[model samples]
Target: MCLNLPQMQSRLLLISPGQSYRLAPYLKAAERLGVSLTIVSDSRYSLTREVADGIQGDFTEPSALLDAIIAQAQTTPFSGVVASDDSTVELAARIATRLGLPTNSIASATLSHRKDLARRQLQAAGLPVPEHWQLDLAREIAPQLQGLPYPVVLKPVSLSASRGVIRANDPDEAAQACRTIARIIAPLSNPIERQTLLIECYLPGQEVALEGLLQQGVFTPLALFDKPDPLTGPYFEETYYITPSRLPDAIQQRIRQTVADACRIYGLHQGPVHAELRIDGNQVWILEIASRTIGGECSRSLDAVLARPLEEYVLAAAMGNPLPVERRSGASGVLMIPIPRAGVLRRINGVQEIRTLPHITDIRISMESGQVVETLPEASSYLGFIYSTADTPQAAEQALRNAHRALDITIDPLLNS
Candidate 1:
């Protein structure tokens, strides 16, 4: 979408690490538009390669991060500000609000980032949210868990990518899960405290991920990704995301409607909205929603529809420009390479063999040898991402499975173990 804004120097300020899995496509989009971008990040992006100026800082400190962004803006104002992940979304909202840019309200951003707040708001809106409780680390969680049903999900209030999200089948399991989550979040410093967590009755149904944009509190559905692997989990490590949904059109529309209502309830009036929803018969339960696109390499599934990258749409929307929405015509999918165990990555073999799969488009191993890799309930990073597109959603999904089967990842025990 192109906007009819007054002609002036346009530069976007992105709040994300350069190495972020979500940055490359957006960088490509900005490059195509010749839009200069400045980044506020903790690390450098290889994709930028000195092309984009970067400011180093702790993104977790919202106030300090906003101050840095404000200081930079005084010298060279930004046309828009955007976040690269769940951690930065709040900061981006603050920056956009401070700059008087078009974006969702800070309150909305807060609700979107914090699971506890999101559940409260949705419940108040009369939306279907699982029965849950907000437990403060300062108190005894066991007493609070007395009446709540088992097979509940215990999660960090603001963590993303399923980090610290654990499903407990009983009281004993719930207690252990809480302790495990506390340990996982202990070292992180953020506005939301590690002591705060949400435990909700686990909803049973097939899960689907919705990626779209919200304009004036209305939702424009872009893609709906079907999670082929059942997420019925002790731990949810997302794998395949196949789009051009296999769900019936009626069911898909219902999903969109539910999500649109959710955006309104959350007060998300603009920018990208990535939502996870579950379906069981006629019931549609929203698991969670983010005021951003789908995270990780999963987002690549929706890129370059109608010759425009997904980031292009996001940028246009941020500037309040009217870029026409276009989605890729056929089926597309991405397999987020899940970490199999907690160990030091030793080597990755058989990339050449994986590439031999007919539908494989790209194979990227994100983690390097020597780096420690851990799976869900403690980790956010994926081992890598595999991309595939086919004439049908089933074929694309199968290709991802086939390609994954061909790779051999070697992880050695920790040095001290």
Candidate 2:
């Protein structure tokens, strides 16, 4: 979709700063459209938050933060609010609604960010989705699950990037795994036992994502990407996303149609969308959907591969401006560097060699020398990303993975510190 011409000057308030974690694309998209950006608050642990301007109160407290932002926004006349992480997307929607601006419905935001809620909602809508259930931390394991199967996925309902997400082979294993998940959030919430849990029937097949723009609950599939690594069971950390997913045309159509129905069923409005689908046979299961934008280095992939200005689409939509319907053509992919353990930053190898590949467009390493990096203490652990675009999807896909494997990483722990 082509964004209508810019009607007026627009200034946007970015809720969180960008990085490899998530929402980096949202910030980059705003930059592409030349939208004036003021950092609202920082949620990550990096030193980057100091670069942000408005760091008032706290972000987790939705009401307090909302009031502060609205109070300040009235004077600044911030055109809109945006959040890129699953942790705060709903809050972003709430702030927009509170300000009487065009925003996604909070109920919709809740459905998208919380996996268990989304699955149930989609099931009600009769959309294809994974079989999942809510695991109350304080409740006993389901009695029927004693004879159940293994490899079931257990995760936090509202968490993303695989945070607190794990898999169990049997009910006994499931009970132990639930204990570990329960411990991770104790400091973050009181009576954390009430935290939402998801035990899902693990669906196997090639994992693919649909990147697009959703206008008034209508989903427009822009590009399809494939996940090379097996995302089932265990952790959900993504490794590579190569666009022009190798799926046949028929399968691609089915994926798009299924995702479109999901966006509508979940109340997605005008904005960027990131969707995950697992296909086995003719069955297509909707994994998750993000209302704000795609996480990881996907925006970079679309930029380098599709050769389009995605930031513009996000900026225009957030400002109530028309989104650019047509995107530049080309195939693109992004490789996310995975973490094996936590320790001090050391060194990276093979980037220079990988960059030598003809299809490789650019390579970025977010980890700094001497900086501490760890395996997803909770699943969002990625050091950096590799981006590439080419004439053919195969070439782009091959070049990205080959380049990624060729790259090396070295980490030395700062044990005493």
TM-score of each: 0.93, 0.88
Using lDDT, give the best candidate's number: 1
Backbone clashes, candidate 2: 12
Tens digit per residue, CA lDDT, model 1, 186-301: 88686355789899989888899998887777688888889989988898878888887888889999999999999998889988889999888778898899988887467677
Q: Which regions of candidate 1 deviate over 4 angstroms?
A: 1-8, 42-49, 60-68, 304-306, 415-417
Estimate, for each residue in 340-411, the C-alpha lDDT of model 2 and write its tens digit.
677887888887887788888888887788887767535455788888888777888788877877877788
Write down the lDDT that model 2 would get: 0.72
**Model 2 worst lDDT run, 10 consecutive residues:** 1-10
Clashing pairs in 1: 1-322, 1-323, 18-45
Give each model's clash number: 3, 12
